[model samples]
Target: MSMNDSWYRASVGDVTQRDALQGDITTDVCIVGAGFTGLSAALELAEAGVRVTVLEAEQVGWGCSGRNGGQINPGLGCDHGRVVAELGADDARKVWQLTLDGVELLRSRVKRHNIDCDLKAGILLVANKARHVPELQSWQHELEALGYDQLAFYDRDALQSLLKADYQAGVMDWGGGDLHPLKYALGLASAAEAAGAQILERSAVLGYEEDGRTVTIRTAAGQVHAQHLLLAGNAYLGKLLPWYRKGFMPIGSYVGATRPLGELATQLIPSRAAVCDMNTLIDYYRLSADNRLLFGGRASARDAQPNALRATMRERMALVFPALAEEDFEYLWGGQVAMTMSKAPVFGRLGRRTLFAQGYSGQGVALAGMAGKLMAQTVQGDAAGFDLMARAKHWPVPPGAPLQTAIRALALLWYRLQDSR
Candidate 1:
């Protein structure tokens, strides 16, 4: 489907367009990609009285930030137990707390800026299979032990009362919820601009060169010389920084929005909480402000044809709610999700002046904004939070595209097998 057909684009009303980079400029920090990460940093830095310039390849929030599932899920992309095992209890607790803080940060931003993004509360992580039930229960206990108390376990009957799905069990996270992703992103951009940052759209960065003291970023029409550079492009970073590409694989995830389901929507999800199964390759969905069932799943390492994407999404959605098999999808679109080998976010510094954070996997809605804030803190001489995230190890994929593709295919195949079991 044409990206222009995105329901987010249609629902966001009109946004003020900014001019592209037109002439050489200098700033304290030059950020590339005006998505959540960059825009969040811009808002923080600008408010701190720092000269920040954000250059976007397209309009602000044009990437996954604007097109994500909008589920404000708390915690890391990977399992919390694995994180505790890898980083140990103390650091892992800190990391877990940061994720929770991320959710709150998003809420505070919406309230502080009066962002009309339809923010809501509650999320259900349902068990797709009987085997997954024990795992979800254990996870909930683990979080409770770590001082998080806003979770509740639900049996199949209890889950059925809330969500009309044949799931075995579920864990309700009262802290997490959903929102209009594009509107949240646009609000951030506007807040950042109002805070004294300059945002340039349609100014794709061609390349950049640094000479010890300063980094010069080039665009088609202009260049930016700044003391520091932040790369926040995520999957869309492309070949700008090839080394970072090896650390994450860009996976295409598609979402389909059914025509407003009205009362059917409330019947399917009475709690109005965003829901997702616990499969290795899970199906996530939530109700839009207008009551449309916005379902998402069917991810692939490589891009698929739009028709095929829509068909697969339809099939997936039908699997959850068979009554909607014949429902018409009013909108369908795909966005790139950067998945690291470990599924943890990748944050680190390059040399002394360049920094980057990406590979949020499918958990960028809240975390990405927090990451940007932490990164800005690092730039302003406080690296505690950013340092903790940077400490997590992220292995790089094989060097070649062909090898990487093969690895991703094998991984997906393995996940499929696990899901089937």
Candidate 2:
């Protein structure tokens, strides 16, 4: 397989490439990064009759938005109880509501825009080990106490009915689902463009200068001066925002798509729901519309060694379904997800006029889009939700990239060590 031959790209068919920014431009809002967050923000801003300009370093959805597990899983990367402990009751509830809004926002946008991304409803959190089942039970109790009844617990037998896997038990979340990520992203982009937003592909932001009044963003061939700016770049943000870089760690996750499994697909996951394990290093997967199994999981914090990634992912898949051992995976890809120290998203102002939302950890599919919506609202003079997010604290990473990488490596090693014993 080629380096970037992802299943999402292959399944989405041909995509029209947008031209890079070639000259100076001015807009009401300028957004850097054309992934889900950026495009979604542009959509909201454009719908409100605001002149929005979106600049992408690569094509739209070229980042983790295009390369995720496609699971519209709910909640923060951490447990709700942990959130309550850290943020206190009222703030935790508010933040939790934001995530729920994120899920609804995604569903409504897809419905209103008629996005054909093969969206299906249902997600199961399976336990790979018996000890994890009790943790899931605690999670269930916490959610139930919080009046969230969308989740239903399953014993090993009941779970087997939904998934023919070697899992101990599972919890089914009706609120979560899966979709064609790249297609959904492109659909958002199209909707934003139709609503009067200018989207420029391959137009990377070199730097920016923000005054209290207007912010000027410099690109290679052009510049954008806007009343407000958004940094929705997430893991790919790089050194663009030096101060913001330390707030999160860029961790790589890999995915592989198997050839169409025909009737076997239905049998593997009878409910056809997206599924993931409740582990620090999670294994998530869902069936494609054409019956391919899009399996994905965590890799190292660096660019993946394709052959090694494929082997490890395939081995993990086989553990869940021994029958797939002989199956051939046709596509393989990976992308980085930003993980904040607290495992919660970071949403705040760069200065006063520039707002940024990122560090969704691994659950960005729904939340990142919602974060975008919140950013749009802030630009429109409504900062209720955005302010709530900004209150969540974020810690800086170690200074240098090498030091950061070493820290992440040690963290992953510690997690893996715990998982082993």
Candidate 3:
């Protein structure tokens, strides 16, 4: 099977194709999907001496995990301030700490496993409009109240000095970072395998059969019978498990990596920070370690390729740094992510033995990795934190999903209007 033309595929060379499911293969645990959550869970499980087998429908990292903007940013997709407003300050504090720990956990994994994915430090939360400066300031205030310190303010004047665009301001998070997403995913898979987790590529799970305490994952070429099952197939999970899919509406995001930018890349963001805008449907771009500008945004709920990659993304990237208006695009591809109505991740039980987690929106890089380990903890009877996250109800797409696309379009229009204002 041909892999998607993701930035990771281009940067990391060809993905190894594993034959589809074959005969019966039993294990202590069976995890579907080779993306962040699945592989993260596998890595943790194997470390704990848990027998684990990870099955990917295609090659590992062949999903959004390898094909995103690669911004290992902190926090969920929504504003941490919004979280404070909705869930009260105490709960919001807990969530905020979790996100902080999420980033820390990601860094620890990369270092502990000796994985070299070009983990660069710092991410800039750039404001596209002048009005957004207040929000960034307010966020800084809240973080200060929370005793968080690691971010620097880049005022309009400061932005002009460091950037080539006419932007209002940006919040530079010294703690957050960027990386080669595909390479990171592959490294995670390799680490899990080294730790005793069985990883097989091209194993599309067809169906699962259960009898008493044993659950058998039936793949096209083989079957994995295990006592515990974890469903980490975020958006590629077509119908292997209908209940898990119901919690999220699959949506697509496109990314285009320009030809390496050489010195211009460092000049764009001297700190080489990942840049994301302030909007519900926003644009995010960052410089690859190799200096290619990786830009991502523009949501599509259906199966549609970007209309004009160079023109659209280059325009958006130029919005942040107009110096890249004519940057040459090297590869353009789209990958789908599971999005819940609340935009928070869903992690809970499916039936009695199966554990499920998905819908990280766009901030799954670290969150998903942490989620997998937490899910493993949940399986081991430590469910306090996992329950809190799982209990976060997901407002799924409309029953027929007929209005989802339209709703997202209108929602984008409304946010765009608000952003412009």
Better of 2 and 3 by lDDT: 2
Candidate 3 wrong stretches, greater than 4 Å: 1-3, 81-88, 243-245, 400-402
Compose the digit string of candidate 1's lDDT tens values, residues 1-421.
Answer: 3456678888988889899999899999999999989999999999999999999999988899888889988899888877888889899999999999899999999999999999999999999888988899988998898889989998999888789988999999999999989999999999999999999999999999889999999999999999999999998987777663447888888888889998999999999999988988889999999999999888886777555777778888888999899996888888889998788998888778988999999999999999999989989999999999988887865666777678888889999998988
lDDT of 3 by residue, 271-322 (tens): 6677787866788888777788788887765656664545777777776666
lDDT for residue 58 in candidate 3, whole number 0-100: 77
**TM-score of model 2 (CA atoms):** 0.97
The per-residue C-alpha lDDT of model 3 at residue 120 equals 83
TM-score of each: 0.98, 0.97, 0.93
Encode model 2's per-residue lDDT on 133-222: one tens digit a residue: 898899888878878889998998988889988889999999999999899999999999999999999998999998888999999898
> Candidate 2: global Cα-lDDT?
0.88
Candidate 3, residue 36: the lDDT equals 93
Which is the leading candidate under lDDT?
1
